[model samples]
Structure formats: structure tokens, C-alpha cells
Target: MKRTLVIGDIHGGLKALIQVLERAKVTTDDTLIFLGDYIDGWSESAQTIQYLIELSEKQECIFIKGNHDVWCEDYLRIGKANRTWLFHGGALTFEGYQQLSDEEKKKHLNFFERMKLYYVDDNNNLFIHAGYTSMKGPEQEFYKSNYNWDRTLWEMVLTMDKRVKKHSVLYPKRLKIYNEIYIGHTPTLYYNIETPMNAINVWNIDTGAAFTGKLTVLDVNTKQYWQSDNVNELYPNEKGRN
Candidate 1:
């Protein structure tokens, strides 16, 4: 049977990304769903995007946009760097793009332009970069920023998982909408977790490749996961989004 692999935040660690794919034994038959933040942090952000563009040509892939991705896209389109972005790993991404030609930049920009904020599969599994506020669904969400920035969804699940029964009237209706929901903006590392973390049906796959943790790939159906060596270990000389 084919696997539907859900990938976590990359944060420009192309080596870690490649390692996880190899460790997972990914093939064209597998469907890859990336939770975004493809760039920023490490020194290889531009090269990472190039690899993904090539990877998608033959493999089945779905890309969701994250907050860091938005910053990269903005810089590529407007040619002005955000000071806030620079503080949070954008400087590395800016430097990575410096060597690329204008045509290549446009192609990369187009790739970012095509990213989706959220996607719901036939099985009602939600793949979003971050949490949403809408009780109905992400489509019902008014502020699109929540799709890239909110942490309340995960926070709620963590707080309520043991307190409320899923069938209880007090259980979160938002969690009831999907069979499973996968997200990446908030790192599992923040919770001192080195692997994917789960509360109820929400899976937090961001193992913090942007910082000191590893990159992870999850088989959405089997819940079997593979991880790369710590990104900090991969680039000892570079401080990755520290």
C-alpha cells in the first residue's frame, strides 16, 4: 500500500530534508504533504526550494504555506526584506537567494505563490501550516493569518485532551470536524519533545528543524514516523534560527 507522508517544517535544512526522505524510503507512489516553512534558518533555503520544485515534477506533493514562507515570498516579490523576518532567520534565506538569477527568482516566487494555506483530504484529514480559529473549518476562518500563526488549536487540544471526552458536549467542535489534523508552525521542541507530538487528533509534526531538533516525516495513516539527525548536528558551524 502507498503511504501518505506528512512532512514537518524544513527551515532550510536541505540536508535534513534529504536525509528524512531517504530514511523514510519515499517513492513516487507515496503522496507527500509538506507543512511549509520551507525556507529560513539554515544556509540552504534557496537550494531547498529548488529541490522541492524538482521533487514535485514527478512525485505527488501538496504544499501548505507557513508564516516564514510568507516572508520569503514577500521579499522575492517586492525586493525588500522585512526587519522582523531578518530577526527570525530571514537573513539566511536572503543570503541564499543572492546567488540566484532573476529568472530563477521568479520561478521560486511562483512556487511560493502557488502554496495553499490549508487543505482537507477526501478522508476529512486537515493539513494546515498552523491552527485556525473557526469552529466550522478553516474555510470559515475570517483572518487568514490564523492559518499561518495561530497556536490556540493545539493549546486547546493539549489542555482538553484529558479533561473532556470527545463525545461530551463540552468537547471542542473544531476538533470534531476532521478525522485528523496535522500542523507545523509551533515546534514540538518547545514542549521539549524531540519527535512529533499528538493531542487528540491533532498531530504537531514540527520537530524544530529550524532550531536544535530534527526533521520528521509521518505516514499519516500508519502513524509511523521517520526523523533526521538533529539539524544543529547537521550544521555545527551555523546557528540555525537560534
Candidate 2:
């Protein structure tokens, strides 16, 4: 059977990304679902996106829009650059982007523009870059902006009891929306773990590649995961998101 490989935040760590992909043994027959934040930490942000674009031609790829990606889109669209975004490793992305040709810049822009806020596959598996706020499924008419910005969704899951009855009552609508939900953005390192974590059916896969953690790729169906060495080690001389 074909597999679906869901990856975590890349944060411009091209080496880590490549390592995880090879470790996972991803193939053209498999579907690669990226939770986003592809750029903005390591120095190879543009190169990372370029690699993904090339990968898409060989396999099925689903790219989700991350908060950092939103910052990237804003800059590409209006030439607007946010200082806060810059401070959060966006400068690295800007630097890498400058080395791209005009055609390459357009390709990157198009890739960012086409990313989705959230995706619910036929199996009711939800893939999103950040926590979502609404409980009325992905179609609810809420602030669409929160799709890539909210934290309450995962926060609630993290704080709630993993027991079924208790969680069902507290997050009844949320749990009813999908069989499983996978997200990036909030790194697992915040919880002191450097691997994908599960809580109340939600999987937090951002292993803090932008920090000192690793880049992770998980098989959504089998729950088997693979990771690169600590992201910090991959770039011995360069500072990550700091």
C-alpha cells in the first residue's frame, strides 16, 4: 500500500530535511505532507523550498501554510518585511531568497501562494501547520486567519486528560471532526521531548528544527517515525533560530 509521510517544521534546515526523507525511505508512490515552516531558521531557506518544488514533480506533495510562511508570503506579495519575523529567523530566508533568479523567485512565490491552511483527507486525517480554533470542522465560518495562528486547539489537547470520556466532553466537537490531526508550528521541544508527540488524537510533530531539536517525518498510518540528527549538529558553524 502507498504510504502518507507527514513531516514537521523544516525551519530552513535543508540537511535535516534531506536526512529525514532518506531515513523515512520516502518514494514516488508515497504522499508527502509537509506541515510547513519550510523556511526561516537555517541559511538554506530558498534551497529548501527549491528542493521541495523539485520533489513535487516526483511524488505527491501537500504543503501546509505555517505562520512563518505567512510572513514569507507577506514579504513576497507586498515587499513588506516584519521586524518580528526577521528576528525569528526570517532574515535567513531573505538572504537565501536574494540569491535566487527572478524565475526562481516567482516559482517560490507561487508555491507559497498555493499552500493550504488545513487539509482533511478522505480518511478524516487532518493536516495543518498550526493549531486550529474552531471545533465545527474545517469548514466552519470562523476567522480563517486563525487556522495558521491559533494555539488553543493543541493547548486544550495538551492540558486535557487523554482519557476518552473526559476528553470527549471537553473537546467533543474537535474530536468528532477527524480520526487524527497532525500539526507542526508548536515544537515538541517545548514539552521537553524531541520527537513527535500524541495527545488526545492530535500529533505535534514540530521537533524544533529551528532550535536544538531534530527534523521529524512520520508515517501517518503506521505511526512509525524517522528523524535527522539534532538540527544544531547539522549546521555546526551557523546559528539556528535564536
Candidate 3:
């Protein structure tokens, strides 16, 4: 069986991310999947994008668009939008951008636009930035428009009757898209949590690394999780940054 490493939200902690990857000992043959939130929160947003772009070029790395990344793209396109961008850990992303040269800023913005909303491998493992949508029927039909910046769909998935939420109600008939689905966005107390219904099937890898929690990575096949010990201590005063 091929080994797949699914990573949770990096939140611009490049130091912690590099350490996690090094610890995982990722190689060219292994598939490394990132469940978005690549930028925003700590610092080094631009550098994080550059590093992911470089890694994508060299190895089998798949990226999904996280909500924060959507905010970054919007800020780059229109300079501003909702206050959620500033409130939900976007100020650090702005700080990272300010540290970059004009050319680098342009490069990272372009890269962000090209990120995929979801990645589904041949093995059936689904990787999404946030939670999966609650829309049903055909996969392509739902993913085409619903996957991009659809907060309503994400909310439904997160709060839907906890019992059915584990399995993709968005497309009930086709729930077996993969052996399991890996996601971020919702931080869990544990580095990884298996759905009560599915045992070790559905995995939530976000351990609130940007807040008072740890960053997480999981080996899907083995169900082994790796986590950072500390949060970004220098995240800056949230109120002041906003």
C-alpha cells in the first residue's frame, strides 16, 4: 500500500512545519497532502507559500484551499473584504506580506489562486481545506461551484447531526469515495480523532496550532499522528494586530 501523509493547518509557522516534515522524513515516492490554512496566524505567510510551492514542484504534494487562504487571495485581489479576515488570524498573514518584496508578494498571490479546493486520490481518501460540503448527488457537480468559498456548506457539515456528519451526507450514496476522509479547520483536543461512528475512519487533524494548541500530521494508512509541542509563542497581540 502507498503511504500518504496528511498534514493539518500550518498557520504560517514555518519553523514548526519544517520540523514536522523532517520528522516525517517525507520522500519523493510518498504522497504528502496538505489540508490548507497554509498561511495566516503566526508569521512567514509568504515564505510558507513559497516553501509549499517549492515542495509541490519537487515531490508529490497536494494542497487544498483553506478559508484563511481564501481571505489572503481576496485581500490580494481587492485589498480588503470582511472583518473576519482580520479577526480570524489574517493579520499575521498581512505582516508576512509586508516583509516580502513586491515581486515575492505577486508570486505568492498568483500561487494562492491556483490552489485546489479538494484532492481525492485513487485510493478514495478525500482531502479538503475545511469540512466537506453537505450537498448531495454527483461529485463533480457539487465540487465545481460549491467547494469554492462556500462557508454555508462548511457550516452545515460541521454542525449537522453529529451522527451523520462523519459520513459525507453531501453525497450519501457515494460516501465510499475513499477508505477515509482527512480534514482540518475544526480543531480537536487530540492530535487526531476518529469518528465515534467509524472508529478510526474519519480523521480531524487540526489541533489548533495557531491558538493554544499543537500542529498535527497523520499517516492515514497507519493512523499514527505527529504533533508539535508548543503553539507559536510570538503570535503577536491579537487585539493590536487587528
Candidate 1 residues 71-143, lDDT tens each? 9999999999999999999998998899999999999999999999999988999999999998898999999
Q: Across residues 1-242, which tens digit of lDDT does each residue of candidate 2 receive?
A: 79998999999999999998999888899999999899999998889999999999898999999999999988877766899999989998988877878788888889999998889898989998876666676667377777787788888888876555633566568667788999988988988999899988899999999999999999998999999999999999989986
Candidate 3, which ten residues in sequence have the lowest lDDT sum? 191-200
Error of 3 at 228 (Å): 1.8
Query: TM per model?
Result: 0.98, 0.95, 0.77
Best candidate, TM-score: 1
lDDT of 2: 0.88
Error of 1 at 151 (Å): 0.5
The sequence of per-residue lDDT tens digits that candidate 3 reaches over residues 62-128 is 8888878888988877666458887777776777677778777777888888888887778777777
Clash pairs, candidate 2, are none
Question: If ranked by lDDT, best first, what sequence of candidates would result?
Answer: 1, 2, 3
lDDT of all predictions = 0.95, 0.88, 0.67
How many angstroms is residue 62 displaced in model 3 relative to the true structure, after the best TM-score fit? 0.6
In the predicted model 1, the residue pairs found to clash are none
